[model samples]
Target: MIYEMTIQFRVSDISKGQHWYETLLNKKPDFIPHDGFAEWELLPGCWLQIAEGIPSIGSGPLRLGIDNLEIERDRLINDLKIEPFDIYSREEVPVKWATFSDPWGNKVGLFEYHNQSEKEDRKKTIVGKQQ
Candidate 1:
């Protein structure tokens, strides 16, 4: 049983990133240390933090999903000046989705859950009909 986890973000400007996160999460950051560290307690003990740390390529991947894909995508572009790419598709899995990188080049995703239950959902068959 898991309670919470932090989504760590590395940024060129930690303060600016923290400000952008405040807007995105619609809440003031829980804390901002003078020394290039800021944290927003997203849920209970969980947090999303930005720090002025060096970024490196990593094997572990992180992703986040949103119900409103377009709105989230636009906000990143308009406010944070981050670029994104659409990799996997909605029709491919009955849900619209895309990937975005954070200011520190961490991969993130945007998703719209048009279908939640997998059992009732239909898949395309060889005959081009619902399976």
Candidate 2:
């Protein structure tokens, strides 16, 4: 059984990648193991690693669950100067989501559950695990 997981994103330059990710995540990396790598504990057991290399082309829109989709989209657009993107949902879908690319072309996405209680509960679970 898998106890934990990490997703790695490669970029052409570590310095630019680090700064962009720090701004997007609103914090510095939780760990920096070397000159060309950084990692963030995005959730209880989920880690995101950014490394210096050629970025994966057409790989993903790695969607992250969030509390407010619109707010984040707006903030990222303003702060990162990213092209504006729309948040979308369907009647059968439980969450709304938006996808965008980082400076190095890593696809990143954000989503928000339709149920506020469920969202709060998930946040509590993650926070409790951290504490």
Candidate 3:
């Protein structure tokens, strides 16, 4: 059966990539096994690896769930100097989201659930797993 998972993003400079990700995630990496790589355990079993290499063209908008998308969007803009981007949602969709690129062109985004109960349930699930 399938188990834990990892997702990787490439960058031209490992140190810069690590710093950028640290700022975006608001924490240091969980692992730095070697000189050119870093990894963050985003959730209990989900890992995001950033390595030194050519960034993948049109690779991903690796979206992360947030409690407040507008707050995060503002933080990214003020702290990271990310250009402003539009947030979008649909009539039936339960979450609103926005996408922005990192300095190295890695597509990243934030999302927030419309239903407060659903968001609370997700937080409890993740916190329980981490403990």
Candidate 4:
């Protein structure tokens, strides 16, 4: 028996979906099937796939994990043009994670280590959100 972990996103438009995902993943897809789909091999088994449809608001019992969240957060903001739907953080937590909504409403997360400077920055944001 064999198992394939493919996460499918129903996109509103395949072209826009492809561009949005390309920006996030930093490359074009490894494959395109027919006129309605693309395959982005994000990890060894996990794939980011988009096909023609209305797109899901979100249906998550799923997430892509990383060793550190803050580093990626910085890159996403500075290098990859990520604007988050929501940002979350805490001073004491060693992980700094954020969420981004793709063009067709798929969710993407970026993360980095909560080093002292990052912790201070996030602490302010978290504290500000509380007020």
Candidate 5:
């Protein structure tokens, strides 16, 4: 059984990729074992790895859960100079989401749950209760 998981994204330049990820995630990488490689533990067991290499074409639109979609979208556009993207939602779906690309064309997305309580519960499950 898999106890932990990691998702990797390749970029042409490690420095720019690291900086972009730092801005997007709002923190420095938790580990950097060597040059051209970096990682962030997105949750208790989920890791995001960024490396220096040719970026995979049409790789991913890796979605991350957030507390607010609009706030995050605005912040990214303003800080990272990302192109404004649309947030989409369905009547049957419980979350709103938007997708954007990094400079190297890695697709990244953000999503926000409509039910705040559910969001908090998921947060607790991932990181334990907040005091």
Candidate 6:
């Protein structure tokens, strides 16, 4: 059976990429095994990998769940100098989301759930596991 998973995003410079991701995630990488490589365990079993190389033309908008999309977006803009992006939502959808790109053109996004109880429950579960 399938188990944990990892997703990778390439960058032209490893040190720059590592610093950029650290600023974006607001935390240091969970692991840096060797030169030109770093990893962050975003969730319990989900890992994000950064490697030094030419980035893919159209790689990904690796979306992350947040407690406050607007707050995070504003911080990304003011602190990271990211251009302001639109936040989108659908009547049928339960979350609001926005997409932006990293310095190396790696697409990234953030999302916030509308249902407070659901969001809190998920946070509790993840935080509990981390504890």
How many steric clashes between backbone atoms does each model show? 1, 0, 0, 6, 0, 0
Please list the C-alpha lDDT of all candidates, in the order they appear: 0.64, 0.89, 0.89, 0.68, 0.93, 0.91
Worst 10 residues of 1 by lDDT: 119-128
**Model 4 residue 79 lDDT?**
56
TM-score of each: 0.64, 0.92, 0.93, 0.64, 0.96, 0.92
| 1-131: candidate 6 lDDT, tens digit per residue | 76688999999999989988999998999999999999999987889999999998557889999989989998999988989999999999999999988888889989999999888888887666325
What is the overall TM-score of model 6 with all chains considered together? Answer: 0.92
Give the candidate number with the greatest lDDT.
Answer: 5
Best by TM-score: 5
User: How well is each residue in 1-131 modelled by candidate 5, as lDDT tens digits?
Assistant: 98998999999999999999999999999999999999999988899999999999667888999888999999999999999999999989989999999998889999999999989998898788985
User: 15-49 in candidate 4: lDDT tens per residue?
Assistant: 87788678667799998978989998775566778
How many clashes would you count in candidate 2?
A: 0
* Candidate 5 ranges beyond 4 A from true positions: none
Better of 3 and 4 by lDDT: 3
In terms of lDDT, model 4 sits at 0.68
Clashing pairs in 1: 90-95
Worst 10 residues of 6 by lDDT: 122-131
Give the Å error, residue 113, model 4: 4.1
Ranking by lDDT: 5, 6, 3, 2, 4, 1
Better of 2 and 5 by TM-score: 5
The alpha-carbon RMSD values of the candidates against the true structure, listed in the order shown, are 8.9, 1.8, 1.7, 10.0, 0.9, 1.6
